[model samples]
Target chain A: MIIGKVSGAMHSTINHTFYDERKTLVVDKLNPDGSLTGDYLIAIDTVGAGAGETVLVIDEGNSARQIVKEDNAPIRSIIIGIIDEVYVKI
Target chain B: MIIGKVSGAMHSTINHTFYDERKTLVVDKLNPDGSLTGDYLIAIDTVGAGAGETVLVIDEGNSARQIVKEDNAPIRSIIIGIIDEVYVKI
Candidate 1:
């Protein structure tokens, strides 16, 4: 799982059939300390996550396929839930 | 697929049963220009990859389980092949 923040959205004119009705977002991965690492990954959103919202992303193929309801979809990374808060023990 | 370089290897006595005879290596993901991002992930190696060798990593659960011959292994990263070379078009 990746703790990331939704940075932006993406759109494709010619793409796979599974992504026809899904919203793909550009998510910036956060470090363990909750700081942005400046690296990003594209993830299919399940929960209604908007820009700047922290989310939980499952970067596993089976999990993504199960949520998208397609076993053969060539996809990994799905926003499973929205993260409300994170606390790091010092 | 993730283009990464093997940084080092890891050993854990108490781990999952599926990892008993497998070799897990620390891989540093590379950017499109082949520069290391400094972040690392542990992956089970299929090919005999050594430290400092560039490799291709499949970070999908289904693919990892397929290579390990287990349908339910809790794995997502696998070093599928040792990369020979990479070229980026300008």
Candidate 2:
């Protein structure tokens, strides 16, 4: 899983059918030291993570679909967990 | 989902509980134009993707588990499909 910060929310009126009950969020990838990696992705929110909160993102499609129990969701990323702390061994 | 090329294979005798029947592969993320982005990841193979094959990767955990029919698998990435062609409208 990749560490990311919820940066913003995305609203789309017309999207795939599986995204009906999901909220999308824009996430910026973060390094282990909590610094930005300058990369971003739009991910579905499963844990009600808010903007600026650190989240664990599942960046695969099938696993993302399984989180919502949709076998054929056209989604690739999802926020699975809200992280409180991260310990990196030096 | 992300497009990637299977660069190599991974073998771990001692791994997580869910990885017993899985084959791990090393994949390099690729851009739309078939160029390397220099990003690499280790992914479980659901399909029979081999070295040098372009494949579609699911980077999520729940979906990865769903593909293998394991709910509590400690895996986050999996190869889902093999790509045939990519069309980019410039």
Candidate 3:
């Protein structure tokens, strides 16, 4: 899993069946030290994470499909948890 | 899913329940144009992908768990398919 910040929401008129009730968000990847990596990804939100909130992203496909209980979902990324804090020990 | 090249294998003495009999590999992320992206990841190989082979990676957690048919696996990344070719349009 990786830490990311929700940047914005994605708007799509047509999508796969698994995404019918899911909300897609634009997320900016964060380094372990909480700095931005300048990389962005569109991920489905399952934990009700909002913009600017830190979230835990699962970037695997089968695991993402397991979250929604779907066997075949076209999605590869999904937000699974909302972050409260992150501490790094040097 | 993202495309990557298998760099090497990973060996661990201790792991989770779902990792039994599974092979771990080191994969280098690749750009869409088939260039190296300089990002490396440790992934569980589900297919028969070996070193120096191009493969498709499922980087989500739930989806990865679904692939193995395990409801609770500590793994986050997994190899799903071996790539035969990649075509990009300018």
Residue runs of model 3 more than 4 Å from their true location after superposition:
B1-74, B77-90
For candidate 3, the per-residue lDDT at B16 reads 31
The superposed Cα distance between candidate 2 and the true structure at residue A67, in angstroms, equals 0.7
Extract clashing residue pairs from model 1: none
| lDDT by residue for model 1 (B1-90), tens | 456889998999998898888888999997534688877789988778889987666677775776677788999887766655443321
Candidate structures ordered by TM-score, highest first? 2, 3, 1
Models 1 onward score TM values of: 0.53, 0.55, 0.54
Clashes of each: 0, 8, 15
Residue A50 lDDT in candidate 2? 88
Off by over 4 Å in 2: B1-74, B77-90
In CAPRI terms, where does candidate 2 land?
Answer: incorrect
Native-vs-model 2 lDDT? 0.74
Question: lDDT tens string, model 2, B1-90?
Answer: 999988765443332334456666667789999998867666778889988899999876677768888774556888999999999995
| TM-score of chain B as predicted in candidate 1 | 0.93
iRMSD for each candidate structure, in the order shown: 9.6, 9.8, 9.7
Reference contacts reproduced by model 3: 0.10
What does each candidate score in C-alpha RMSD?
8.8, 9.5, 9.3
Candidate 1 CA-lDDT value:
0.74
